[model samples]
Structures are given as structure tokens and as C-alpha cells.
Target: MSTTEEPTQGTTISVTEQAAEEAIALLEGESMDTDIAGLRLYVQQGGCAGLSYGMRFDNEPEEDDTIFEHHGLRVFVDPASMNYIEGSVLDYEGGLQGEGFHVENPNVVSECGCGESFRT
Candidate 1:
């Protein structure tokens, strides 16, 4: 597992060390199993950028993929989706504004006004 900072210009892409650490902390207290391994981040066809982000807790990984570790949290990305989400960050933000997990993707060329969809 390696930890490094990869920066980008738009939407503050690239998952930061702090974000990963926070993810782990939240997961630990969610009443779920702490042995969840890590999160799987991917891009699927749909949404307003012709592309959309997908995330889930997964224990198994496919044969060819990149696994990144930040503050003991592991994040997995499949090769196929990597091209679309190369410089994106996976963040968990909570507050009255709207508490939920969000993706800050720089590759997004246009997004739906609702902010639930994007096109790139």
C-alpha cells in the first residue's frame, strides 16, 4: 500500500491523503465490519457527462486494477474506468447542506444543474 499526493487543476481532483483517512474513520464507526477491506471507485456510462461515478465497499478485486492506500484506507479502481476518472477525488461530506458521499471530478465537461449527473 502506498500513499502519495497527485494534484490536478479543476474541481480539486485526485483523492487526497486526508480524504482517505476520513473515509476510514467514518467506515469504522458505521456499525459495519471494519474488515471491509476498502472502497471500489469506478465510472459507469450514464449521467449527464456520459459518465458517472460509482462507489461501494468491496472485499474482492479483479485481476487487473490499481489499489491505493491512504491512512490505512484502501481504494480500488478498475483499469477500464481509470481513463475517465484519472484525476478525481472520492470524498465523504456531511452537513445540513446535504449529507452524503460525493465525487469531485475534473474530467467532467458539463454537469446537470441538479448536480446529480454530468457529461464529459
Candidate 2:
């Protein structure tokens, strides 16, 4: 978020080392410039639990977005989504069964059985 030396813990959201590595690789694979390109994390109204997680790669953060720099990766979160997942952590799980990014949200009170959605 700053032009100066990047802050370690100043980021509002956090991403795990494994998750950051995987996301960064994905970003680079997209051929997007890593300097400005970042992953956007947001929440939307849907799914069995009332809210669903959404993510995508963006060329650059919006004017109102809160940029989080962590583990050599950049994450963008809008104000609305931040309200639902302020203290959430992004993590990646990889194995034979399945592999993907997971949101470890402390604000979540209940989650759908399939784990595709959750209620704060």
C-alpha cells in the first residue's frame, strides 16, 4: 500500500506462505505484471450459507480497495467484502485428493456442509 518499505504486519488481511506461493504462481502464469497485478478476494450473497467467497486476478487495485502485501504477494479487498472477512486468512491445501485456496475466517459462525459457503 505504500511506496516506501513494505510493512510486515500492517496488512489487514493475511495469507499463508503456501497460499501466497500458489497464488503468485497463478498470477505469473496469467502473464500479468506482478508489480501491478494482484488477486482480489471478495464476498458475495449466494450459496447455501448466505454468503460465498469469490476471487479473481486483477490488473491493478481499485481506487477504494485496501491492498494487502504479504509473503511477496498482493491481495486486494474491497470495503464491502472487508466487512465480512476482515481478519480472514488465506491458505492453500494441496494433495492427491484436491487442491485449492481456503479462507480461514474467524468471524464465521456456521458453514455449509460442502464448505462452499458460510455465515458470519
Candidate 3:
């Protein structure tokens, strides 16, 4: 992870160290090449708030996707999704009461009661 005072230009999102570690392990388990494979983050219309965060392992990013590397984990986001999730942070919280992977999106103005959706 580059930890300079300035963030990488055009970096719209980042992943926490813990989340990156977990994601790497999962990618390895899937036998996917971490160098090219990445987790795709996007927004979809659904849930009570009209927008929901979606994530899935992608073999590679699309030509129009914006890619960022944080803590050695690659995250791919499309142009449309970038408008809604800029400056967001992806994190993982696990314990007895776990809240798996979640996005802390600064663009969100409100979230649904279920916490699965948000309105920007």
C-alpha cells in the first residue's frame, strides 16, 4: 500500500488492510490469479433505499472499469458506480456478531433500516 500524504490520483475507493487480507485468501481459495483477478464493486437498484452495494470476484476488469489497488487488493469499479461510491472504503468486521464486508460510502445521505441499501 502506498502511504504517501497524497492519495493516488483517480482513486475513487480503497480497501482496508483487514479486508484486503481476507479477500486475498478468498481469491486464493478460488484458485484465481490474484494479479489479474479482482473484486468488482458496483451499485444496483434494489432494497428499500433504491440502491444497494454489490460485489463479486471478476476474472479481470472491463475495458471501461477504473481499477485501484489498496493493501495489495485490486478493486474494479465501473464509471457509473464511481459517481455513487467515490471516496468509499471497503472493510471487514468479523467476530461472534459479524458484519462481513461492507462499504463505508461518503456519498450516502441515508441508509435503509436493514443497512443493505443507501440513498446518495
Residue 80 deviation, candidate 2, in Å? 0.3
Model 2 worst lDDT window (10 residues): 1-10
Q: After superposition, how far is residue 92 of candidate 2 from its true place, in Å?
A: 0.4
lDDT of 3 at 43: 99
Error of 2 at 27 (Å): 0.8
TM-score of model number 2: 0.90
- Against the true structure, candidate 3 reaches a TM-score of 0.90
Q: For model 2, which pairs clash?
A: none
> Where is the poorest 10-residue window by lDDT in model 1?
2-11
> Taking the candidates one at a time, how many backbone clashes does each contain?
5, 0, 0
Off by over 4 Å in 2: 1-11
Score each candidate by Cα lDDT.
0.66, 0.87, 0.87
**Structural RMSD, model 1:** 4.8
What are the per-residue Cα lDDT tens digits for candidate 1 across 2-120?
22333223312345666676667666766545454677788887765466777877664565656665556777777677777767777778678976678887777888877876776
TM-score of each: 0.72, 0.90, 0.90
Off by over 4 Å in 1: 1-13, 25-36
Superposition-based RMSD of candidate 2 using all C-alpha atoms, in angstroms: 2.7
Instruction: For candidate 2, write residues 1-115 as lDDT tens digits.
Output: 3332433453468899999999999999999887889999999999999999999999998887888888888898887998898888999998996999999998999999999
Q: How high a TM-score does candidate 1 get?
A: 0.72
